[model samples]
Target chain A: MNTSSNDKQITDDLMPQKFSKSGMIWVGILSTICVIGAYAYYRQLRYGLGVTSMRDYVSWGIYISNFVFFVAISLVGSLITAIFRLANVAWSTPLTRIAEIIAVSAITFASLIIIVDMGRPERLYNLFAHGRLQSPIAWDVIVITTYLFISLFLLYVPLLPDLKIMNQQKNKNSAWQNKIYIFLGSFWKGNSEQVKISDKIINILCIMIIPVAFCIHTVTSWLFATTYRPGWDSTNFGAYFISGAFLVGAGGVIVAMYVFRKHYHLEKYITELHFEKMGRIAVMLSLIYLYFNINEYLVPAFKMKKSEAAHLAELFTGEFSIMFWFAIMVGMIIPIFIMLFKKGRKPLPMFITGIMIVVGAWFKRYLIVTPTLLHPFLPMQNVPDNYKHYFPSWEEWAITMGSLAGALLIVTFFVRIFPIIPIHETITEQNEKDHSK
Target chain B: MKKIIQNRYLLLFFVFSSMLFANRSFAQEDAGQEIVKLHYYNSNNSIQYLILESTLKKNKVFTPQKDKTYQIYLDSAGTNLIAKVKTDAAGKGKAFLPPTLKKIWDASPQHTFIVKAGDEEIISDFIITKAKITIDTLNLDGIKSIVATVFKFENNTWTPAKDVEMKVGIQRHGGVLSAGDEETYTTDSTGSVTAEFKKLNLPGNQKGDITLVAKVEENEFFGNLAAQKSVKWGVPTKVDTHFFEQRTLWTTRFKTPYWLLFMAYSIIIGVWGTLIYLVRQVIKIKKLGS
Candidate 1:
């Protein structure tokens, strides 16, 4: 296509598309899940965390696992936007907005789900009112909050130019769209100085976000690592968490990239090459995660340190053995095996690998949290017999699924306003390529 | 003014205070046997001994039990019989600290020592505590000189206890100092006296956290007093491994360490600093258009 025709095609294809029937149906289903989750949460609030099967021994059930999964998936925003940008990787540019929205949405739910875990949600203000400097819980509150805002800023700054682009396209949108654009991006002139400053700020954020991102997850790992529990006490937790987080995040992006490409029909922009690169990246991260997994289990298994023996046995051959192996196989092993092949890196196959990774990762977090709690150093006694073994009550499942649905809802709504692909960046890149030709 | 006041401890007999408690209900009354007056004795915490004094009340007047044998049960739960002794002509019988005392101590902080002869019985209620030595607060210095005190309660007022042999030592990481520094020395007539621990061992914390414990071993009066005070002495010599000094990393206590404070503030400053600047940049963008 010629230059102006190409511009027209790109704008039409890449601008925020309307929700199709399936999209509305997807929205409806997600909303229904969220409403059910909200009701479950209301019941939890009325009855307390007792509505969930979590007890004194296995106190942190699925809610913590879900929170961790959200935090883990949120790392992708940093991987794609910050790490890739700093590395000067060009191919990921079109996918930045999608990745960041996922980060922001996942983090929002990560924050919310943790509160849902708190028996007294009203006590959250106590974190600020009597916030201690030494507690890992306090460290988490600080870093996660910092990560959220930085992630928001990172999401917002790049979208200014695109927001301005949508603003000028009077024929394409409604008055509501115009109002949102004016409220968020009316100041954007696309002037050289403004772009210059925006780019500088982006560079600063990309650099600054890297450590904060590492800290948020590493400190989260410390929440478990710092404890004396059999499975959680490890020097290897930080790297282990970060690596798994990257794999899950990469998997999430591949899934999003596929959906956006197929649904919006933007094959030319989000191409086969992107999926292939992401697959390779996912495999690399999974390998790194696999190494940590071996270290996390093997050395401890080698010692059988009396404390860790039961926990390791449960993971190896007991009740959790099945889920444990499944998480390892599907989350890490199977994804690694699949993505190793050229065929597997194809969009359709890659999408399946992404699903496997994301699902497996969620179970992996559940294993990380719940199993160790069941195997405390002391005998699990005095608590009700049910406390000895944790099975998530229906309310827990609903609320966990709801928090997930809520995160997806945020991503869904973000796409409705902001372009899933960056319009201004895409056009500029295309213009640059055309000029060079 | 609470002056030096005849050393640290003043023993006072508070019959008036005991009289103030009127119309109290007790479980059972002695059938002619006066309640056992239990006195725990120790000199420099060397030997722990319990002295039991029982007087025969004949026609509601105090009289010596002469040579009657009374069995003293240790725990209030009545599970263990600690000692059997014959009362002296002066109305006193005695027993040493038994190994079972620790087991009974674990269950209840307050111990009920029961003395019985035939149908007549007398019970004494007492609390066991670590004997602690206190020094006026002073800065850490080598060759530290200090004094500690013990008091007895009798005659309605706390008076300086006499003949209290307080074992003075520091609590080590492990191993009890039951002997060696076990020599018995009586507290002065004023109930307040000083013991100089020459060649004192310093617990390596440059800012000392070592507690000097003064244990008044088995005494005829006071059961046991384990008083301890945190002292900074001898330029603390132990190296602390914790990066944050607020509380050791292993502790369950919630304390904000200087390192964490620095970390939280540093990130907050870096992040919020950049964000405020970015917000200003956004504001500048609006002004550029207007």
Candidate 2:
């Protein structure tokens, strides 16, 4: 296994490194975005929902869709870490921390963005007080909270050993970084007892997280499906949502892998093989999602009932037509086509494809919520003229962008603090690879 | 001497004949007695009239009572007047009597009556029978026209009237068409009164009861619409009977079983809980297998 030289390299290469010029620029950009988002949220609170173009008709706009998007992207963590680990897929070991960080950050913002979608944010307590157990929103609260805790636990358990390692290795970075490491991980004595227990607990939590992840996304889809809306009234909604979630989550991993590999020079850890494998998973999920799309659209199209006709027509040929088809082609079909090829599954091509899928899926969530609401049972009538249309205001855009940036910042900070690749798992895998050779 | 003799003889003869005739007439009349010419009229409509006669005397005191208050029973049912009355100053006064219950043997049945000083209270051991007034025809130009076959108990059958004669008074069609409109136009036997509109511009739906009312010679006719003892021809127009029926039905339906709501909630929650559990179990096994 070339233990001596490999150990030297691992110790040197895997240590928490300083942010370079580009890394600083990226952090600054993300921080600026988060700040803008905070200010925008303040404006929204003051002016009421009136600050947003969303009226009573389109009660949920971009923030809710983006929230769903973030949650969807977050599931990649469980898919890569727990699902692959249980499946004995050794290639995904190095990518586990990377995926888990993304999941944690994305789920965190998903929760936040949901609060932003609320009209009576102050009366958020009513959710607990007056919560009708039958309401999908109540179910969402229950399951999402469960998912968040499990995901957080999953992220934290794996980071304990890494935290101890960081604390032991002295660095030139400021005292604050050292303090953060001490505060977060000082309790870890690195005893075999702690390590064994931590590993067992992490395994249990990772296994628990798979179903919880499925529930969070599935229930989120139910939030739309439980409604009488034409577009959302499908039994295939849970599968549809889960498949699309895996696609976006995988796309997120691809993009994150590319970014971290380039910025950190961790090509040895996050290799082309990871990108290729992730790209294949992304493509497979995209196709599965596209198949559900056919079921979601085609069966309804066959009959085109009185209520569904207008909604379907709007997606097919009306104002939403462009966005609808664009999301399908760019998000699912194009990414599927790109990932089908070996060269396209390379890091650079996969990153571009991942970006397309993420962007497309965002629009797709928007498509899921808006078009159905616009075409209600009764014609949109007796409302203000502007109520007929829904274009998110600047505040909505800012909060949405901020939430995205916040998720990124979560991943970025997580990577900054601990090894983005699992240092222990990667070294172990590298030893195995060397032994196999 | 001759004049005194004539006066004594005539006085003796008059006293003897009056004594003998009184007993014979009283015995004969008592054998088959019936209340004849029993009819009612309300000159000033403040008082309502209910009639039941006793064959015991020419004048019977009557007491009136309401059959029911507004609740408990459906129609003024089970209510009765316990008081009695005699005839009035002109041998007639009003009594607000409870409606008759014809089911009982009428040997000494209680009937409400009222009277003034000269009126006598009478009770008879004879059966009281229902009586009705009948009219042959009704016609009101441009509004209503009917050959009204009214029934009366005469010759032991409820025979329709062969002939009818009366004057009907029509009120002026006020701008708002209703019984509230006030004026008078009389119609004699030639053309009897039905509900007919004088002006076509009047609201077609405007209606009121056409009461066959008689005038009392001595009493003043006050403008009390309720005072008229109306022999209602068809039906009263002022009352919305159906509206009250609908209101009653609505109130009764709203008292539905409360348990239905709880059952619905329980079913919904139970189904959702089961679905969550099933999905959770499936995902758990799938994760373990993976």
Candidate 3:
């Protein structure tokens, strides 16, 4: 195709489209789940955290697990958008917006889920009012907030040119939609100077986000590792958490890629090659994560140090054995096994493997948080029987499911309003390729 | 059909009335089972007090009955009213024996204390007696001992009160520490009980002075009597009161370590400064577009 025709085709293919019947039904289901979650949160507020099964022993329950999961998944934005951009990987251009939206939505809920876990949300001010500089919690607060703002700017800066395109295509959008586009991006005149400055700022943000992303997850890991608990007291926790975070984030992007590609009929854009490449990245990340998992468990298990013994036993053979083995086998081992082959790297198998990794990573976070809490250094004395075990109540499950649905809803709404694929960048890249030809 | 409906209505009325009466009767039974305890206390032969406690049993647990009123009388007949007290949240009511009853108390060798809560009453009688305790310290060959003697006024003469049980210890802030292993001691025929000081290297004030205390507590005849003596028998140590002023991790936000403050502020300033510069650059882009 000629450069002009290619640009036209790219723009036509990439413009945001109306939802289909299934899309409408999907949105309706997500909305219904969100409403139920909102009601559960309302009940939690009206009553207290007692509405959940979290007690003194299992104090950090699935809500914390959900928070960690969100934080973990959000690292994909940094991986796909920032790291790939800085490394000069041109293939990641199409997936940048997808990764950025996932990061934005996941980090947003990470913050909100923390508030839900705080039984008295009003006392949230105490975190700022009486914040101690030495507390790891304080460090987490600082880094997570900084990461959110940086991620927003990173997502927004790249979209300026696309917003200009959407603004120009007035027939494709309603009057109100055009108004929003103009309000957000009318300043983008697409002059050479403006493009130069935008590129410079985007590069600066890309560099800045890498360390902040690492800090956000590392600080989250420190929230556990800083404690003297048997399972969490590890020197390798930061690396362990970061590796797992990258794996889950990459899996999340793969899942989103397959769904958006099939739904938007973007087989021409998100091709089999992207899935194959991502499959390789997933295998490498899974192996690194597996190494960390072994380091996290094997060394301690070998020692059978009286302090870590109970915690390890609970995870390996005791109450949490089923979940532990499931997380390891499905989250890491099976995905590694499946994605190793050439056929498994195809879209359908990769999608299934992605789902497995994401689900397993969630349970891994739960096991990381809860079993250690159950096996405190101090024996479980004088506590009620229910305190010794943890199972999420209906409210916790509702709220957790609601958070997941809410994240999907955000991605869904984002796709409906703006092109999920960056139109301007895609056109620019396509023109460059055509010119080279 | 009308006759059957009338009979059913009559039966329902009987069942409902019986349930209501059953609930009322259970409540009345619970009310009748309120427990009242009366205690008399005379401290230092100067202050006399009457303490009354009220409680109710519910679900096999004794729960305090707050805001319950109780009347104290000085006689079994309940004629001489001394004080009226109300229970606090802990179900205890306390009142000092009023000066108005001093004449009646002085005229009698024995007195009856009565506390009445509604229809329930508790009576306790005590013999009026005067006693005094004197604490003495002895040092023999590097061994220190605390000796206490109790005497009671009988037949218009001061005589040693024998076989009176008392406690001899070194006085601490909240309670007394046993000078030796035994917690309590009974007086011999000479009305004296001795306890050897066994605590070694116990820290004390800068001057190394510790107060030795001896007391006869709640005796049937003596009420409560106590005596104390100060001795230089403890190891003196200086305390630093300005520890919190030091810069430490556990200190308040204001007292954060200088190094930590420097590092944290540096990161904050570095990151936020970059963010601010980026924001300004975006604004410049907007300006260029305009």
Number of the top TM-score candidate: 3
> RMSD of model 1, in Å?
17.2
Cα error, residue B68 of model 2, in Å, equals 53
The sequence of per-residue lDDT tens digits that candidate 3 reaches over residues A1-437 is 67778877888899988899999999999999999999999999999999999999899999999999999999999999999999999998889999999999999999999999998899989999999998889998999999999999999999999999898899979888899899989999999999998999899989989999999999999999998999999999999999999999999999999999999999989999999999999999999999999999999999999989998998999999999999999999999999999999999999999999999999999999999989888898987899988899999999999999999999999998898899899888887886787
**Best candidate, DockQ:** 3
Candidate 1 C-alpha lDDT tens digits along A262-347: 98888999999999999899999999999999999999999999989999999999999999999999999988899999999999
TM-score of 3: 0.82
lDDT of 2 by residue, B244-274 (tens): 4542312233332345436535644554454
Which prediction has more favorable TM-score, 1 or 3? 3
Q: Give fnat (model 1).
A: 0.53
Candidate 3 residue A62 Cα shift, in angstroms, is: 1.0
Candidate 2 lDDT, A1-437, residue by residue in tens: 36868965875787767788888999999999999999999998888878888987898889888988988898887898889988989888778888888888888888888888885687889888776554567768877776776777677767767776677776644688889887766777666656666666666776677877887888899999878788888889999999999999888888888988887788988889988888778878988999999999999999999999999999999999999999999999988889999999999999999999999999999999888889989998889988998888889999999988988888777777777776666666778778888
Backbone clashes, candidate 2: 17
Which whole-number lDDT from 0 to 100 does residue A415 have in model 3? Answer: 94
| Cα lDDT for residue A295, candidate 1 | 95
**Candidate 3 deviant stretches above 4 angstroms:** B1-39, B42-111, B115-169, B178-202, B205-214, B222-237, B241-246
Candidate 2 CAPRI level: incorrect
Candidate 3: which pairs clash?
A: none
**lDDT tens readout by residue for model 1, B1-290:** 35545333342235544554532422124346554677765445346566777776755888877786777776553456777888888988878767867666445433556666654565545544423233333224533534567654344344566667766656567723422344445678776645555535555366766666667655434566666556654357756546544564444336545575576788788788987897787778777765
State the lDDT at A274 in candidate 2.
88
Q: CA shift at A367, candidate 3, in angstroms?
A: 0.4
